[model samples]
Target: MSRAQIEPGGCLILAGTPIGDFRDASPALRETLAEADIIAAEDTRVLRTLLQRLGVTTSARSVSYFEGNEASRTTGLMEEMLAGARVVVVTDAGMPSVSDPGYRLVAAAIEGGIRVTSVPGPSAVLTALTISGLPVNRFCFEGFLPRKAGERRRRLGALTAETRTMVFFEAPHRLADFLTDAAEIFGVDRRCAVCREITKPNEEVVRGGLGDLVSWATDHARGEITVVVQGAPARVVDIDGALARVRELVADGVRFSAAVAQVATATGMRRKDLYEQALAKREEHEDG
Candidate 1:
C-alpha cells in the first residue's frame, strides 16, 4: 500500500480501463484520463478507441508503454514525472499493474519520489472471484500458468493443497488444457469456475467441479478468461482415526496405497502418515 504524496514534483496515475464493456468506465477514470499531462498507454490505439467510446476528449500526450517497451519507456516517463508532469498509465484493459504493465513505471515513480495513485475500475479477477460463489475470505490471484503442458501441470500440482480460493487468468485456447490439468492434480471433484468475456454481453461463468469445467472449456470458449478454483477442503487432524479409516478401506479390498490415498483426500490427512501408521498398527497386532 503505497501512499500518494501531498506535494510532489508530479504524480503517476494508474488508470483502470474497462475489461469488456466500455460502459463500465468510471467517472473518475474518465476525469483522470482527461486531466492527464501525459498518458502512457499499453496500446495507444486501444486508448484512443476508449476515449472516443467514453466521449472524453483529451489534449494529453499519448505514448505507447506496453510489454515490448515497458522497460525502455519507464525511464522517459520517470523523467516527465520529475519535471512536474502528471502522467497517467492505462493498460489495454483492466487495472494497469495487476497481471499487466505499469509495475515497473509505478515502482520507478515511487522510487523517484513521484506521487502514485490509482483510478480503480473494472477488474476481471475481482469480478470473476465475486461471481465464483466460492469462499472469498481467503484467496490468491495466480495470473496465467505456464503455457506448456508439462510446466502447467507441475504448477497446478504444487497448488493441489492450497486452501485459499485461487484466481487465474488464462487464454481461451489454453482453457481446456489448464482445466484438465487442474482436474488431474487437484482432483476431479474440486470445485471451480470459469468466467469469460467479463462485462460484455457474451459474458459467461461456468461453475462446477474441475472435471466439468474441463469438459466445458473443450468447446474453446472465446474472449478473455478468468478462472476461480475452490481450494482444498480443510484436513482432518486425527492420525489414528485416519489410519483406522485406511485400514477399514483396505480390509474391504481397496489396495493399501489406494486406501491411504482415498482417506488422505477425504480427511485432508497426509498419505504418508496414514500409510506408516496403518503398517505400524498391523505390525503391533501381529506381535500381540
Candidate 2:
C-alpha cells in the first residue's frame, strides 16, 4: 500500500477534461495520463485527439467507456484496478461523473476497497455560472431536460417556484425549444443567461429575461450551451394569493381539485388547507 508499490488493489483516478479550451487542462491531467496503467475514456478517439493536442504520449491501454457501454465495461475496469493497475477515468469533457460515465466504475471501485481520486479541471457549469451575470450564491445543476415537449414542460412546471439559481446543459438545436418552454413555465420576465461555446473562440453569452433570450435563440445560438436562470422571486406565503392562483387555474378549464393540487404543489402549501380555504371562498362568493 506504499506510494512506490501498486498494491494488489490500486486506485481509481477520475480526471476532469477541459470543457472547451484545451489549454485549460491541468498538469495533473498530463501526469495522470502518462502514469495510468489503464485509461477508460468516454471516447478513445476524442482522447487521442486531446492527447495529441497536449503533446502527451502514453503506453497505457485506452478503452471506450461512454454511456452506451459504461455498464458492461465497469466490471472489467474494476478488475484492472483490483489487480494493481492504475485506472484513470475521463469523459469527453468536464468531470467524469457529472452527467457522464465514471459513476459506475467509481462506485464499483469503492465497493471493492479501491481508492478513488480526481484531477479537477474546467467545468461548463461553473464556467457558465460565474460569467452568466446571474446570482450564483445558491444554485443547482439540472443536467438536461426531457426532449419531449409535454414531458419537458411538466418537469419545468415542477420547478416553477424554485428559488435557487439553476443551471442546465442543453443541445444547440434544442436551445430554442428549451428556452421557449422555460419562458412559459418560469415566466417571460424571469432572467436567464445562455452561454455557448464557452472557453473557445466564438464563445458567446446572451444574458436577458427568458422572453428576450427566446427571441435571440430564434436566430442565433450554437455549440455547447449552458443556461443559468435566476431563481423565482421571493414572496411571502399568503393563503389568499395561493387561493387566487388556484382560482385562476380553475377558470382556465382545470378541474377545481386539480387546480388546488397544482397550486399547492407550486407554492409548497398544504393541499388540504388550500382545498379547504378555496372551498370556503367559493361558497362565500356564490352566497354573496
Candidate 3:
C-alpha cells in the first residue's frame, strides 16, 4: 500500500484507468488503488489485474460494479458510503460515468449527500480528439451512437450539420454498418477518422471521408472504435444553406429539435441563434 491515504467518509472517488498499455497508467491512480476504502470496479478481474501490474496491495474490499449489476450494486455502495467508507468507482477505461457503468452510482451518491471527486487520467475521448485531425478547440463528446440501425441513422443524420468536431465510441462488429450509414447520412465525402485500439500495439487510425472509411472497413477491421466526424464546413453562414440541411434531416424523420442542433453544430453557430433564424425562415417559407 502507498503512504498517502484516503479519508473514510461517504465520499465517492471516480478514477480513470488507462484505456490500453498499462505503462501509460499514472502513479496517482496506483496510490488510489491502495488507499480507497472500497473499490467499486467495473470488472473485479480487470481491477485485480491492474493492481497486480502496479504492485499495489489493497486493504480495501473490492466489488464488481457494471451495467448488469449497477442497479443492485448502487444500494450496497450507497450503504457503504453512508457508513463513512471512501468508495472509489472505476470502469475498464476513461472516466466512470461517460459511456461506462458508473453513472447511476455517481448519481445515487450525489442524491444521497455523498461527496464525489475524480482522479483525472487518460480518456479515449480526449485521446481521439487530440489525434483526430479535426479542430479540437470547440468540440463535443457524444459518447456512443445508438446501436440499432434505424436509430443510429436518425441520430447521425441529425449531426450532419454539426460544426464542432464530434467524437463517438462504437463496437468493432458494427463498424462497417455504422460507417456505411454515416456515409449516407453525413455524406460519403465528409471527413472522419476511425481510431482503433489506441495506445496499443495494433493501434491504428484510419483517416478519410465516410465513403473511404466504409471501403476500408469492408476489408474487415478490429479493435475498439472511436469515430471522429469533422464538423460541417464553414460556408454554412448562408441561411439558405443551413435551411437546406435542416430540411434534409427533417425529411429523414429527424425531430425538429435534433435537426436544429445538427444544423447549428455543422454551421459553427449558436443553437439559440440558429433556432431564432430558423423560425423566422420557416414563417417566411409558410407565408410564401
118-233, model 2: which lDDT tens digit per residue? Answer: 88889999999999988889999999989999998888887877899999999988999999999999999999999999998999999999998887897898888899999988
Write down the lDDT that model 2 would get.
Answer: 0.88
lDDT of 1 at 73: 94
True-structure Cα RMSD, model 1:
6.0
lDDT of each: 0.86, 0.88, 0.84
My TM-score estimates for the predictions, one after another, are: 0.81, 0.90, 0.83
Q: After superposition, how far is residue 89 of candidate 3 from its true place, in Å?
A: 1.0
Off by more than 4 A, model 2: 1-8, 247-258, 275-288
How does model 2 score by TM-score? 0.90
**Tens digit of lDDT per residue, candidate 1, span 210-277?**
99877678885799999999998776478878778777888899888877777776666667877788
> By the lDDT metric, which is better: model 1 or model 3?
1
| Candidate 2 residue-wise lDDT at 166 | 97
- Evaluated with lDDT, which candidate comes out highest? 2
TM-score, cand. 3 vs. native: 0.83
Superior by TM-score: candidate 2 or candidate 3: 2
Model 1 segments beyond 4 Å from truth? 1-8, 237-288
Model 3 misplaced stretches (Cα beyond 4 Å): 1-8, 235-288
